[model samples]
Target: MRVFLGITGASGAPYAARLLAALVDAGCEVGVSASAAGYEVLATELYGDASLPHDEVRDRLVGGLDGVTVYAGNDYSAPYASGSAKVDGYVVCPCSMATLGTLASGAMDNLVHRAASVALKEGRKLVLMPRETPLSAIHLEGMLRLRQAGAVILFLAPGFYHEPKTIDDLVDFVVARALDQLGLDQTLVRRWGQ
Candidate 1:
């Protein structure tokens, strides 16, 4: 699969990292783009240093990961930014409410939003894994709008039904669901009946 993975400014960096790794492991060619604040969260959550520079943070994030390409936020010429690029799917892991609203409003500020817009306009698979809590009416409305537009609003809410033994387990549950939305097979978490 050829997929675009957008890391937005949200609180679930672990989920984003895990999902990126899982996508590569699934033999998918992944294109990644991180907003400024997305770099901050990844540095703080994964590297324990919020002061890390963008290059360092990105290096550490994709150091050993294969089949991945990183794109700049303003790189509109990238393939993922266009509907004619033949992208298999697009996912915004740890999607922020701000991004949700932008997408819902049919506005594009960066590659992430543009990729998502391409997916929606082209009728391709688009999974938005928002990791928010205490959502306001605006957030709910934005999500509903996206769902109505044929995008899957996969909230980053991990289920405890599997009796998670660690934080990784919790993250995997949500990642598994997101992968499922993109039509990628994952064994990160057990199914409800299995």
Candidate 2:
């Protein structure tokens, strides 16, 4: 399967990273894109460097995955831009409010949003892992709009039923749920009956 993974400026960078790793490990071809704010979030929250280069950012974001291709968020000419690209699914892990708003409104200003829009138009799976908390009415409305438009709005709300002992475990829970939605095998987090 070919999956397009988009990372935005939300707080759950780890979730995006782990999801990419899991997708590659599952033998799926992956295409990745990180938004401008996504780079800011990675530098501020994950790497502690405000001026990290794009290649360094990509290296840090996708440290463990192999055979995965990374694309610029602004590259609208990428293969995933067209519905004929034959991608099985698209995921916006750590989706931000701005990105969500764009997707909800059918705005394709960038490759990430365009790929997501293409997925929706093509009737393929499109999952969004929004990580914001204390959501306002506007955020909820945006999410509703996207959901009604056939997008799976997977908020990065982790469950404690698995007895997570660290931040990584919590992030994995969300990523695992995303993988489950994609019909991929994952051990990133435990299932309910396990």
Candidate 3:
């Protein structure tokens, strides 16, 4: 599968990292784009620094991962900017409310938003993993608008029925769900009746 992953300025870097690793392991061609604030958040949360350069941050995030390409957030010329690229799915892990509103408003001002718009217009699978908590009415309305537009509004809420043991386990639970939405089978977490 060809997938486009967008990282926005939201909490849950672990979810984004795990999802990318899972996508590569699943043999999917993945394209990635991260906003400026997204880079800083990843650096601080995952790498213990907030001043990492863009290239370095990208390197560290997808360093040893294969089948992944990183694009500038504002690069409107990327293949994902158009529906003709045949991208099977697009996911915005840790999707920020700002990004959500942009997409809901039908304003493709950046590569991430453009890719999502393409996915929606092409009737492709678009999964949005928003990690925000206590969503406001505006947030809920935006999510509803996206859902009505045929996007999967998957919240980053991990289920505890799997009995997670650590933070990584919790992250895996959410990433596993996202993978399932992409039609990727994973043994990261046990099934309900397995």
Q: Per-candidate TM vs. native?
A: 0.98, 0.95, 0.98
What's each prediction's clash count?
0, 0, 0
Residue 11 lDDT, candidate 1, scale 0-100: 92
Give the poorly placed runs of model 2, Cα more than 4 Å off. Answer: none
Which numbered prediction scores highest in lDDT against the true structure? Answer: 1
Question: How accurate locally is residue 150 in candidate 2, as Cα lDDT from 0 to 100?
Answer: 89
Superposed on all Cα atoms, model 3 deviates from the true structure by an RMSD in Å of 0.8
TM-score for candidate 1, residues paired by index: 0.98
lDDT (CA) per prediction: 0.93, 0.87, 0.91
Question: Residue 64: error of model 3 in Å?
Answer: 1.3
**Candidate 2 residue-wise lDDT, 27-97, digit = tens:** 99999988888888877777888688877888877776777888887787788999978898899988999
Error of 1 at 103 (Å): 0.8
lDDT of 1 by residue, 96-141 (tens): 8889999999998999999999999999999998978899999999
User: Candidate 1: where are CA atoms >4 Å away?
Assistant: none
Please report the TM-score between candidate 3 and the true structure: 0.98
Q: Per-residue CA lDDT of candidate 3, range 60-152, in tens?
A: 999999889999987888899998787988999889998999999999667888899999999999999887778999999999999999999
